[model samples]
Target: MNKTVWIVLALVAVLVIGAFSGYNSLVNMDEAINGKWSQVENQLQRRADLIPNLNATVSGYAQHEQAAIKAVADARAKLAGSQGVAAKAEANNELGGALSRLLVIAENYPNLKADQNFRQLADELAGTENRIAVARKDYNDAVQIYNSKIRTFPSNIYAGMLGFGAKEYFKAAEGAQQVPQVKF
Candidate 1:
């Protein structure tokens, strides 16, 4: 009887240790997701900040293109006020479309394309877009890992109990798959 009790105690201790390890790992993964998302937001904010300067430079030569300029500003405002991944993604797509139109307008003005300030701002915007892409990829990757963990084996049991639900991915908006046409 005593031997049986000792064996039972050992099993209980092992189970306890395993539970702690699993919980800690989940916490670490959840934190990693948060960090990656913050990076995505940072990149997004950087792009937003660059927009005003870009718009100003474009405006100097394309003063008549008020519709395109207003669209970009409106999209930027929508992005700023947006909450959640889905909403932000939608707003981002709107902003991207508006910016593309704005650029197309710029193309009509040869002097605008040749302007040094416009060139610099455009380059910076392109770089920031790249950074935003990388950051979104990283965030989605982390979410994928975290979601996998919460859906798998023993961890799944406690994950729900601990309130660690699956995280949402930063998905691109619809129509993103289509190639944009640029006609001269």
Candidate 2:
């Protein structure tokens, strides 16, 4: 066989192996990221479920805190209703802010704060928030892995050919951790 023919055959073999490995790795990584995203959604949903109970408990003592309750509800709805990762993350950050304000409102009602039901609900919500933080971290980790695989050299070539794109991180919006200046 000619030298040119041997060289071409060797190049083709390497490409075939590289393409297969890259494509498979991308698929697995994408699936892991998607799974992590689902966990994040579930954690957020759990927090949303806790809102109505928390609001009702607080409302019994602070009836006039209407606008604040509505704000929490609205933010939860937005978080649930959003369609994409960026939209959901933005909404989640807003919801966190709104709920923080509601907690601050709770501080004004000493009797309510001392109630067992209210205390339990608050504890559950706090636990949910912790879970959300952990879940978001996991989701972001998966996103980093997937995005890296989808962008790196040989994998990037395979990713483009296979229609894989960079997965988004569920990032906190501005002031996500700040105490909201509650007008209520």
Candidate 3:
């Protein structure tokens, strides 16, 4: 009888330990997802901040390109006010298209392209875009891992009990699969 009781106690202790370990792991993964998302937001904010200066430089040389300038401004505002991953992704695509048009208009003015300030701003914007791409990839990767964990055995049970839900991925906007046509 004593041996049976000892064996039962050992099993109970093991189960308790396993439960604590699983819960801690889920919390860690959830926090990791939040950190990765913050990085994506940081990169996005960097790009948003760069837009005004870029628009100013382009406008000085291409004064007649008011429509393109306004488009970029409007897209930037939309991105700023956007709340979720999907909304931001859409706004970002709009901003990207606007920026492309603005750049093309700048191409018509050799002076704008050659200006030191414009050149520097353009390079910085390019770098920020690259950063944003990397950040988004990182965030999506985290989301994938978290989602898989919450759908798998053992962890799934803990996740459901703890109210941990799946996170959304930062997906590319529509029409992004099409190749853009460039003209000289």
The model with the greatest lDDT is 1
RMSD of each: 1.6, 2.9, 1.8
lDDT of 1 by residue, 1-184 (tens): 6999999999999989998999999999999998998898898889999999988988888888988999999999999999988888889989988998998899899999999999999999899999999999999999999999999999999899989999999988787788979899
How much is 56 displaced in model 1, in angstroms?
A: 0.9
* Candidate 2 global lDDT: 0.91
Estimate every model's Cα lDDT from 0 to 1.
0.92, 0.91, 0.91
44 Cα displacement, candidate 3 (Å): 0.7
The digit string of per-residue lDDT tens for model 3 on 1-184 reads 6999999999999988988998888889889988998898899899999999999998888888999999999999999999988898889889988998898888899999999999999999999999999999999999999899899998888789889888889989788888979899
Compute the lDDT for candidate 1: 0.92
Report the lDDT tens digits of candidate 2 across residue range 43-135.
999999999999899889999999999999999899889989999989998999899999999999999999999999999999999999999
Worst 10 contiguous positions by lDDT, candidate 3: 171-180
Q: Could you tell which candidate, 1 or 3, scores higher by lDDT?
A: 1
**Cα TM-score per model:** 0.95, 0.91, 0.92
Q: Report the alpha-carbon TM-score of model 2 versus the true structure.
A: 0.91
Q: Rank the candidates by lDDT, best first.
A: 1, 2, 3
